[model samples]
Target: MPGERTKYAWRSHILAERALVGAAEHAREAAELATAIEPLAGADDVVCAYVPIRGEPGDLRMLDALCVRNATVLLPVTGEPGPLSWARYEGPDSLRKARFGLLEPTTATLPPDTVATATTVLVPALAVDLRGVRLGRGAGYYDRTLGAVGDGTRLIAVVRDNELVDRLPEEPHDRRMGWAVTPGGGLRELGHELPVSPE
Candidate 1:
């Protein structure tokens, strides 16, 4: 069953991509929902977002919305599997080709302390369980970066509607999400700890 689960999980990238492309409208709605849910995003404060690689959910829309609202956007420069560093996003012109179909920071670079000042982090996830456990792209990037937010930070998992399931297979090092955002639905809080309900 574990092998089967892994197979299904691997295929989720494509399946979720279809879901996201089909529900592009929901992406926009989710963006608006984000602005409404976190009015602080509209402020001049900085929010970190990923240059969406696969069809995870809400890539440019989220970043563009934040920037359009006058919020400073910070993107991660993928380093080793440890804590992440932040670089200033200078609009669309600063993006450049990178591995894993992702975009990298080419314009400005910020210190680690500045990234620690981020109020929000838009993390990419495969499937997030009700217990807040997030199954990422198997890269463990987010798991390492979650702690980089310092204290009192909010990490929102961006995924498709179906991707937020009742449970996900958990590993010890896996990190949890404070909140989740999807298109079809608004935002949901996974603040409290919930059991994984082992299959």
Candidate 2:
């Protein structure tokens, strides 16, 4: 369980760092992320995304950008510790305060398997390494949920530029991200050509 312990330490370090980010810098990065995420999907695509909470990267504007492209966007609806259910994100008005201090869409919920319908999923992460290994909060929601996605679906982690690292502790059940989008980096492919190594 050393990897799990390392993961927790990484989470603490990253969250502490995020907590110290200045409001001006956070806003600038959020605006940049909004622009970066704007063209990610189009009218034909169904995107599974999240509304950032705490010091997570991006903001409501990022989700709005996806809507502006006419993409059908789905947001996670949390329940018990298992795969996440989903709901359509209509707009800011459609969100209601939900469990875990999250703002979830008020729309009717869909099954966890609904994520399979998405062309892209914007996963929230504390950090993502060059090998596509993502460091998430200890919850296993995404680990369980991402398995439902069909092959070739883009599992893209959303993080700040510095949050993208060279390596991270990867667990056996951990699903790898195919791409990462940062405020400054836009989008970059991961793990494709890198030599695998133990962290």
Candidate 3:
């Protein structure tokens, strides 16, 4: 309960800060993020990514970029609060609005454990610490989904440059990310990459 409270406080603080970013900045960051993440993708690589909504960093353009590489992109299909089911990302045309303002694929649904098939999993985050602990939007979808990931799956948290923090509140059920893909910073391995300057 204490950790959940701390995570809630951090989410509120970080979101407030994200709301201050300008549209131009978001566009630029989105482009940079697309470029940063493409190298992590390869032909036929299965990449599990989310569609951005609200002010969440790195728009679906990141997914599009991965798609351009011939990667099999899968997006979350919202269901009960647990490991998410997935669907093939057919493109921008195939997304339909789902609950909580989330966009999901309109294609056939894949099993929740489909994430185990991905070589890389890109998840939305409010903030992530240098040690790879990620703070999500209080929904336990990712925490549950990540539990099913393969041992070799590269779990990368997608966030803005500012969202990578010095530390974040973490819990026993919280899974650690292996890397973070930021706009200006590209992909940095957690706990091993040099600290990003807060300036």
Candidate 4:
């Protein structure tokens, strides 16, 4: 319960910071994030990725890049709070507004276990620490859904360059990210030491 309070405080602080990002800056970062994500795209890769909402670091360009490379992309379909179901991403036209202001695919839904098929899963995060701890929006969607990922699946947290911090609070139910991709930093492995400027 103590950690929950800390987690909520962290979420509030990070979200307030995200809210101040200007449109031009956000667009530039989105473009850079797309470039960082492009290298991971492959024709045979099945990627589980999310659409950016609020002031999240990435945009549709990231998904478009993966599609351009012919990778099969799956987006999360919201339902009752539990493991997230999925749906195939056919392109921009295939998406429709869903619960929580999320853009979900309109295609046939896939079971929660479908995430096991992904080669990589890019998740949205408010911040990620050197130890791979990811800070979400206090919703347990990712924490619950990620449990279904198969071994060897790359669990990557997508955040802005500055959002990568030196440390974050970790709860027992929190799944650790193996990697993080930032607009300016590209992709970096987690659970290792990285020089971080003092806050």
Candidate 5:
């Protein structure tokens, strides 16, 4: 139970810390993050992003911002316990309740490999250390999805300002993120020891 214990311990600690974030403050931070990420979207570019659920840092406003920038935003469609399938984000009107209390696009689903076409991938994280080791929810969905991205893709971890930490528990199969975007800090490049390899 060591792995489970470690994972839960970190999860519990961070979630409790996040509980202090008031709804108003959360919305403000989410707005800041939306502004920060807008510049990352390019016209005619495909970007992979997620819709934030309750208690998550950024909200759907970020995705809407990407859409306004003319980027083809891809949202994850949960499936079997492997890499996540993607769906193009049509708009807020196109979202529906999905498994695990997630809001997913009702648009046609794309194959899991569709992530390869993304130029930037914004991932959800509880915390991301300076080394770019992202501490995710124990489900491992982002871990699997990120592993399949093209070598040139920019993997960015989205966390609250204080969630950018000095360190976190890591394993061999763990994938490192290249950047951490915080509500206050904007986009920060991490000094991870191991660079992400497409192999």
Candidate 6:
């Protein structure tokens, strides 16, 4: 079972990268999809996103879209390796260089407390199984942070379509997500959306 699990994770990562490479339409597709979901989600629903590194999910296109709408976008600022702090996205202009190859808000240097109010959290993972188990870059930061999210917040993981698999290796510290989004493809609920509270 362990061998099978490892195989699935590796396969999912490879397939997802390939899918991303083949889908030239992903950037536009993701923006449009996210735009549609913006209003359906409540204003209190703070969205958490990350500044991409190593050409991962390519969310900058949609990230800019979110900013243009003047939505309250939250970016993950790493505290250590296993925990994260959040900053209210003021604008691309408000972002300044920060530790761990990330961007943070210039004015509001918020702590992890902000994530506690997230209505939706967008995460990056190498693979995500049907059970909503996510494989990050070997970091437990989101797992630790997701635990802090207030009730009613839907934790969503964004991955390339092929990254959504039948199963993946789940560590006790790994966090689960309710929905997974991919470019060109619509949303898929990986599991029962968790009940979250509004701030």
Q: TM-score per candidate, in order?
A: 0.78, 0.94, 0.92, 0.93, 0.92, 0.78
The most accurate candidate by lDDT is 2
57 in model 1: Cα distance from truth in Å?
1.6
Clashing pairs in 4: none
Per-model RMSD to reference: 3.9, 2.9, 4.1, 3.5, 5.2, 6.8
lDDT of 3 by residue, 1-199 (tens): 1334587788888789889989999999999999998878889699999998899888878988998899999999887777899999988999999999999989999999899999999989998888899999888989999999987999999998878877777789999999998998999989654457799
What TM-score does candidate 4 get on C-alpha atoms?
0.93
Per TM-score, the best of the predicted structures is 2
Error (Å) of candidate 3 at residue 78 is 0.9
Off by over 4 Å in 3: 1-5, 192-199
Model 2 Cα lDDT, one tens digit per residue, 1-199 = 1335588788988999999998889989999999998998999999999999998988999999999999999999999999999999999999999999999999999999999999999999999988899999989999999999987799999999988888888889999999999999999999854566798
The backbone clash count of each candidate, in order, is 0, 0, 0, 0, 0, 6
Q: Residue 151 in model 1: shift from native, Å?
A: 3.8
Model 6 off-target regions past 4 Å?
A: 1-3, 7-42, 68-70, 192-199
What is the Cα root-mean-square deviation between model 3 and the actual structure? 4.1
**Model 1: per-residue Cα lDDT over 1-199, one tens digit each:** 1323652564565365555465566556556645543554867577888776555556566677777778888898766566667787877788988766778889666655565777887787776767787777667666776766665777778777767776666778876788888766657888565555689
On the 0 to 100 scale, the lDDT of residue 92 in model 2 is 99
- Full-model lDDT for every candidate: 0.69, 0.93, 0.88, 0.91, 0.89, 0.68
* Residue pairs of candidate 2 with colliding backbone atoms: none
Residue 55 lDDT, candidate 1, scale 0-100: 50
lDDT tens string, model 6, 103-180?
A: 677765577778876667878777777789887765567777788876577777777666677767667766688888
What lDDT is reached at residue 190 by model 1?
87
- Backbone steric clashes in candidate 5, count: 0
What lDDT does model 5 reach?
A: 0.89
